[model samples]
Target: IMAVPGPSLFTLRDTSQKVVRYHHNRLVASPQTANAPPGGLQISVVPNQFMDPSHFPIIMGINGGTRCLSCGTSAQPTLMLEVSTHHWGVRPRAF
Candidate 1:
């Protein structure tokens, strides 16, 4: 099996330079092959705290594979974020 680069851990800090939360991130490979009908890669981000229940563990799709056009091994991953007012508050909120 090829050695794929896994996910990395990240944190978020407030204006005061205080770490407000952290992300326990991971990449899950599906049972099927990467070149299947649809992409079999998924990215999950579980926050340490101050997350809405509905969005606590955020899961998103990823284009899976190890092949590259110019480079031999393209092992980089991408993450997209969509921030909104509902994601922040004076206190943590529940779903």
Candidate 2:
């Protein structure tokens, strides 16, 4: 649920900022801050102004626990997460 600047969020860029690969709906990147743990899938979402800020970036553990990740303040627009659930309609978690 991290917020990125625009539709170019998943456009994998090289060190020179050249487009490496465009990943539709998903991305893999390291966090910009040191407080966060590494490695997780980053899926794109449509912008939703009605969403609660606290609900952004919902984090889950492999043990099935749920949590949240805060990416700090950003002037860039962000996407809202409706839910990350299983086919059975239950939300999922990760380790």
TM-score of 2: 0.21
Candidate 2 residue spans exceeding 4 A from truth: 1-53, 58-84
Candidate 1 is scored at a TM of: 0.21
Residue pair clashes in candidate 2:
60-94, 61-94, 61-95, 62-94, 62-95
Worst 10 residues of 1 by lDDT: 65-74
**lDDT against true structure, model 1:** 0.32
Local accuracy of candidate 2 as per-residue lDDT tens digits, 11-64? 233464433221353333443345543333332333332334564432212212
**lDDT (C-alpha, whole model) for all candidates:** 0.32, 0.35
What CA root-mean-square deviation does each model show from the true structure?
18.6, 12.8
The lDDT of model 2 is 0.35
Error of 1 at 23 (Å): 25
